[model samples]
Target: MTTTAVEHGPTMNTTATAVPRSSVGLVPATATLARQKISAAIRSGDVIFAVFGPVVFFLCFYTPLHRQFELGGGDYAQFLTPIILLQAGLFTAITATETAGQDARAGVHERMMSLPIPRVAPFLGRMAWVVVRMVLTLGGGLAIGCALGFRFQGTIVETFSFVLLVVVFGSALSMVTDAIGTVARNSVSIASVLMIPQLILVMESTGLVAAQAFPDWVQPFVRNQPMSVYADTLRALASGSAVEPLAVLLWSVALLAIGVTAIVVAGRAQVKR
Candidate 1:
């Protein structure tokens, strides 16, 4: 009997060793969380807003200003499309704050913490939704712009850069807002506060009207502000012209750095709580 037990032990050990241990991965975990976010956003109608927000914003600006801008020289549709895309990205970021806030209020983060996934999965999951919204906004904006006379005048590379820049800009902002939402209780108030600055930046920007159109006192600010710089870079890329893109690139980098740092801190805080 002892001899038979010993022999069986070796077989059992071998069988146990042959059975693999299942491991979770970041990609699959993030994907699952992302799908959760997408479904929630759909139920909340945030997904619908993603496609229509830019459409409404684009038409709002294009309808009244097109004739005047066109009369100034170039087609207004081509000139105005860049800012619309940028605004779409901003809108995506704004929506992220509210969603993140909702999750925080509902103890979603705490629930997720109990899982064996990476701590950064929640942020990445929300960002995946942000990208989806940005893509939807881009399609909607471009479609409306094309119908209104906008066209891609640049080479494939420049056009691609134009799209890439918008994504980077939006993603950076979304990260920052996500971090803000994770820690803050009043996310809706934060979102409302964000809009004031957003409106100021777009209205005072060279986006809708040339810098010269602004009062002389504000022209310098308008020309050199971050929004104007981004609009300029977007316009250059869209028109296949050469201009200094370094400023906007620098802005993007700075925002990304801030976002990364903020998000890391926010995640660490969550772990502690």
Candidate 2:
């Protein structure tokens, strides 16, 4: 017998190859999570609150105050629409922050960390729902505004762009709130920390009133702050005028950076623990 003829063939590996994760799955997963979150908000009656708050403000505050005070020409309702929409956005952010803080304190992050899903998925899902809530609130406010004589004087494109800007501003504000939420000890702390600054900015800025209407000592701050700049830009966009976009851009970028940094830091700290 020839020993060379008895040589065995090379062995084949029996282990199965692991399949790579598909990016396509991420979209549906994120969307599903966002929908679930939004449904929860609806069940909690937050959706009703978000949609109605602006309408109430428009009816009670803007309607009466616009008549009592000159609001830089045009229908006062038109002048006040942007601010109402902006306020609605801010309210959405506040709600988001409170929810996020509650989740963090309840150890939701810890549970999430054990899952195979991407780390940012939950945040993105919450933000997606925030945008949805904002749209609903803004839509409700716009209907109320129209009933009160608010009209879009600009082209359809400009009108859409104005809405887009409000959404962008709201999204940026939400990020900042999200950052605060991630690290805050509780919902009350989140509210207390954010409410004062929000009031100072929105009330003192050109949102509700013109810079000239403010006291001379505060005129400079009112004229130059991010909220004022945003309001001015949105006003111009709505009425078809020159927009100074720099200030709004800078504010959005700066806040987004801070928000991202805070979230990352908080997440890392949580993970380490």
Candidate 3:
């Protein structure tokens, strides 16, 4: 019997070593609570800012531009609709990262960390919330675009193309903004940091002056920036013109990659207390 037990022990040890351990991650209940809370908060504010803001901004442009530009078959408001949607989207893209910073400041993140939830919960949960807000915000903008006389130029195929472009690029911007928020020491810092991109990089330059009015370098960059491309695509869709679908797709993928890379780098820099 002793000899038999010794022979079996080697086999038992081999089997034990071969069976893999379960990868540690967020417990079901904790993950559920985190997702629910984040989703609810984003949905509320996201609708208000992304949808309502664009609606109001479009109304202001309708009357004045109606008399000015002879936009072929469409009015100035129609031309401006997609641009306004892009603008509204920018406002809500950073919602998640901003909320995460708030959580960190409030000790919520630390409290969650103390529980059995996976270390990635805080990061992934916030990103999920960002995506939710993006949908709400961008959906609202699309509704506003329809109200402002924007319509799909072609079949259902083209409509999907426009939405795909918007979502991808919007998500990229949101991710980049989230990374910035992660690195920001406090809420004030995050707000202050976004001012440059909000005021300068993203603010409307379309239809204001001739593209030639700017320096050669500035002209091309301004025209091809993410917001600019989205606006251009929106206008094309609304006017029943051929849109640059490939350019938008390329830009969207590139932006998402860049934003994700930045977030990972910033996350690694974070020191656990």
Q: Which candidate is the best by lDDT?
A: 1
- Order of candidate numbers by lDDT, starting with the best: 1, 2, 3
lDDT of 2 at 131: 86
TM-score rank order: 1, 2, 3
For lDDT, candidate 2 versus 3, the one ahead is 2
lDDT of 3 by residue, 165-237 (tens): 6666666777777777766678656766665676565554553222564687788877877666767776676
Give the Å shift of residue 48 in candidate 3: 2.3
Identify the leading candidate in terms of TM-score.
Answer: 1
Better of 1 and 2 by lDDT: 1
Candidate 2 per-residue C-alpha lDDT over 37-105 given as tens digits, one digit per residue, 9 for 90 to 100:
889898999989888888998887775687656633547776788888887877878887887887788
Q: After superposition, how far is residue 189 of candidate 3 from its true place, in Å?
A: 3.2
Consecutive 10-residue window with the lowest summed lDDT within model 3: 5-14
Candidate 1: stretches off by over 4 Å: 1-23
- With candidate 3 superimposed using the best TM-score fit, by how many Å does residue 94's alpha carbon deviate from the native? 3.6
**Pairwise TM-score winner, candidates 1 and 3:** 1
RMSD (Cα, Å) for all candidates, in order, is 4.8, 5.6, 7.8
User: Which pairs clash in model 3?
Assistant: none
Off by over 4 Å in 2: 1-24, 70-73
